[model samples]
Target: MVFEKIVEILRNYKEEPELEVTMTSSFEELELDSLDTVELVMEIEEAFDTSIEMDGTLLTIGDVVGLIEKAIA
Candidate 1:
């Protein structure tokens, strides 16, 4: 579920080069700008029906997935 939601967010920016998302993928590799990150955070909160106070600690796709799971749990 977490992976799916994250991929869905990434798909919104599919006009860019194709990216192969993986647990180790970084946001830099995906080329998500600040606005995109904000939208992603908002979409994630809406999708999971929870608030995520994002910090710089999350640095990879796995980190995001873990954070989302932890928040929803």
Candidate 2:
């Protein structure tokens, strides 16, 4: 369920017409900068009804999914 929501959020932000995303994809691979990460974190917080501390760590889609799973659980 969290994976699906993350995918939906990411899909909405695709700048190109044919960008493909996957679980192992990194934020750098997705072209997400600091500002984009800020926004994505906010959306994730709202979706999970929990808080996330950046600590300058999150790198991959899998990382975010893991955090979300922890928060939701």
Candidate 3:
């Protein structure tokens, strides 16, 4: 469920349904800037009913995926 949400968020931002949502995909390739990252984090938090600290550590799509998986777990 979390994975699908991540993919959906990426797809919504990219406006492309064909993009792959793999662990190694870079957020930059999806046209996600710092503001987008913040918004994504907020959305994920709302979806998961949890708060996530947006440290400077999340640098890629994989990082976001990993964080979501960890939060859900």
Per-model CA lDDT versus the true structure: 0.75, 0.80, 0.76
- Higher-ranked by TM-score: 2 or 3: 2
Pick out the ten consecutive residues of candidate 2 with the lowest summed lDDT. Answer: 12-21
Between prediction 2 and prediction 3, the one with superior lDDT is 2
lDDT of 3 by residue, 1-73 (tens): 6778878877776688888777776667767788888887787777777775588888877787787778778
The model with the greater lDDT, 1 or 2, is 2
Model 2 deviation from the true structure expressed as Cα RMSD, one decimal place: 1.8
Q: Give one digit per residue, the lDDT tens place, for model 2 in 1-73.
A: 8887888777776645456767798888888988898888788778778986775788888888888889779
What TM-score, over all chains together, does every model reach? 0.78, 0.83, 0.77
Give the clash count for model 3.
0
lDDT of 1 by residue, 1-73 (tens): 8887777776765553355788888777778766667777778778788877677876677877888889988
Error of model 2, residue 54, in angstroms: 1.1
| lDDT ranking of the models | 2, 3, 1
Model 3, residue 13: distance off in Å is 3.2
User: Using alpha carbons, what is the TM-score of model 3?
Assistant: 0.77
lDDT of 2 at 16: 54
How many angstroms is residue 36 displaced in model 3 relative to the true structure, after the best TM-score fit?
1.1
